[model samples]
Target: MGEPNEVAFRLTRRHSSVPRARAMLHAALGDWSVGQDALDESELVLSELVTNALRVRVPGDRQVGVRILLLPDERLVRLEVSDAGAGKPQIQHPCEDETGGRGLMLVEALAHRWGVEERVGGIGKTVWAELKAQFVVPAPAPPVEVPAAMVRPGQCVRVWGCWRTALGVRGDLDADGALHVVIELDEGPPLRVRSREPLTVREAGTPAAHEAAEPTPG
Candidate 1:
C-alpha cells in the first residue's frame, strides 16, 4: 500500500497483440495480489481497450501504448490504451442482431469509472478504465516467537503483510539454524521465508490475537 505499481508495454497495431496485452495484465495483477473478480474484469476491459486501439488508424510508425497501474491503498486498478488516431472512441448502441459495437458498453458496465484523455504532446488520445480491487484478508501474526519444531504444513502464516499457508519446510537451513519455509499464498507464486522470521499463524477455529478488542462497559 505504499507506492503504486505501474507497468507499460508498447504494442503493434495488430489483432494478435490483444491477447498479449491481456496476458501482460494478468501477470501484473497476479503479482499485485488482486482478487480474481477484479482480475477477470480487468482482462475484459483490457481486451476492449486494446481492440479499439488496434482498430484506430494511427500513423505508420505509431505504436499502441498499454499501461496498467495498481493502487493498493485505494484498491483501484487503472488500465490505459493509447493510439495516435485523431478520433475519440464513443459508445454506440447497436441493434440486437449486430455482432459488434458493444465494446464500450461492456467497459461501462464493468468498470467503476472510465474515460478518454488527450495524450500530452501527442496527436492521439488514451482511453482508460478503472476497477476497484478486492483484496483477501491476511492471516494474523503470532504474538511471540513460534518455535520451528511447532511449524508444519497446512498452517497459515503472515508474511509481507499477506497471510499464506505453509507448504513444507525446505531441507536447507540458514546460518542461524533457521529452516527455509515454503508457503502458498492467496496470489502469485509460492514464497520462501526463514522459519525464525516473525510470523502470525492461524489456529483452527480460533480468532487471531489482534482481533481481540476491549470489552464495552456493561
Candidate 2:
C-alpha cells in the first residue's frame, strides 16, 4: 500500500517567484513518482495559482504559500496556494482579443476539480485543485504445472525449442527445486532441462510439438 506524500513552501510575492514555485512543485512530484501527464497538469495548475496570488492586492512583503499532496493509493493529487490578499478568483469568459483572463479557465479545464476557500485564521483565501493520477498495473505471470508421472524414459517432450525423447528421469524435486530430465533431441546432443512442467508428453503417440504453443493465463 502507498502512503500520502506532501511538500510545502513559501514564496515572496514577485514575478520571479512564479518559476521558482513551479520548479519546486515539479521536483516534489518527481520525488513522489507521479506520472508524466499528472506532473504536467500539476505544474500548469501551480503556475496559474501562483500568478493569481502574485497579482492580487497583497502588500510588498506578503508571501504566497504553496503546497502539494499526493495520495498514491487513491490515485489523487492536490495543489493549494494561499495569499494575503482577500480577493476571490472566478472563471471569466474572455473574448478572442483578450490575452490575460484565461488563467482560471485553464485551471478548470485541466484539473478534475478546483475551488477557493477562506484561509484559516487569516484575512486571505486559498485556491485548491485536485488531479487524477494515471497509475499502471502490471500483468500477472502464466501458470505451468507438470505431473510427476510425466518424467520417464521413451516419453516425447518439447523443450528448449525442439522435441526430444526423455532418456530417463535423473531426479525430481519439490516445488521449490527444479525437476531434472535427460532428453535426446532429434538433431543436437543430449541435453538436460530443468522445469516444473516442461514435459509436453500427455499421452503416447500424441506428440505436443510446440513448447511455447500454450496460452498464458491472465
Candidate 3:
C-alpha cells in the first residue's frame, strides 16, 4: 500500500462495483495527469479484471478486492483484483460469433503484462495487469546548484571555533543580486552554512587567510 498514491478497497459481488472501480482509477490517475489514451486503456483493463473477478465462483459471503497502483518511474499503471476463487484464469480464443469469453483476450492485447498470483496468506488469487502509460505532467527534475570556485571542495574553513573541511559548494543569488555561497562541511555529521560574511579558509595543512568573495553565476 503506497501512501497517498494507491487506492485499495473491497466491493460486494455485484455489477455496480465495476463502475465504482473505474471511477476510483480515474480519480487516481487523473490527479497524476495521465494521458487520455493511457487512462482509457487503464480503465478498460480495470473493467475487465473487475468483471472477471465478479464472475468467479467465490463463496457468496466473500467480497472482491481491488487495488490500483501507479508507478511514476516507468509511467506504469497497475490493476489488481482479488477473489477467493478456486482456479486460475486462462486466455481463450473464441469464435467470431461468440458474444463472451473475450475479456482475457482484450486484457492480454491492451496490457503490457498480465498474470495471476496466489493471494498472500489468503485462500484466493489475485489477478494483476500492468500497462505502459504516459503522464501529461512530467516528473520534476533535481535542483542544480552552481559551484563557487574560491572555496574548493578540498579546503578547510573555520566555523564556530572548529575547522571543518569543505565537502562541496552551492551558490544562490539574492533578490538584491547579492551572491551567497552555501558550503557543505564535513563535521561529525555533514553540515551546511551560508557564507554571507567574511570567513577564514585555507588548505588542509596550511595557515588560514581571508579570501575575497567570488560570484557564482545563476
Which candidate comes out best when scored by TM-score? 1
Greater lDDT among 1 and 2 belongs to 1
Least accurate 10 contiguous residues by lDDT in model 1: 209-218
Model 1: number of clashes?
2
lDDT per residue, candidate 3, 103-177, as tens digits? 999999999999999999998999999999897954433222223436778776666666778888777677787
Two-way TM-score contest, 1 vs 3, winner: 1
What would the TM-scores of all predictions be? Answer: 0.65, 0.61, 0.61
lDDT (tens digit, per residue) of candidate 1 on 135-210: 7666655333364435567776555554556666454567888676655555556666555554556653345545
lDDT of 2 at 103: 95
Candidate closer to the true structure by TM-score (higher is better), 1 or 2: 1
1-218 in candidate 2: lDDT tens per residue? 67789888999977899999889988887777777899899889889999989899867888999989998887888999999887689899999998988999999999999999999998799999999987544333332335434556765555554445666555545477756554554455665555443444533354233234542211
Query: Whole-model Cα lDDT per candidate?
Result: 0.79, 0.75, 0.79
Q: How many steric overlaps are in each model, in order?
A: 2, 0, 0
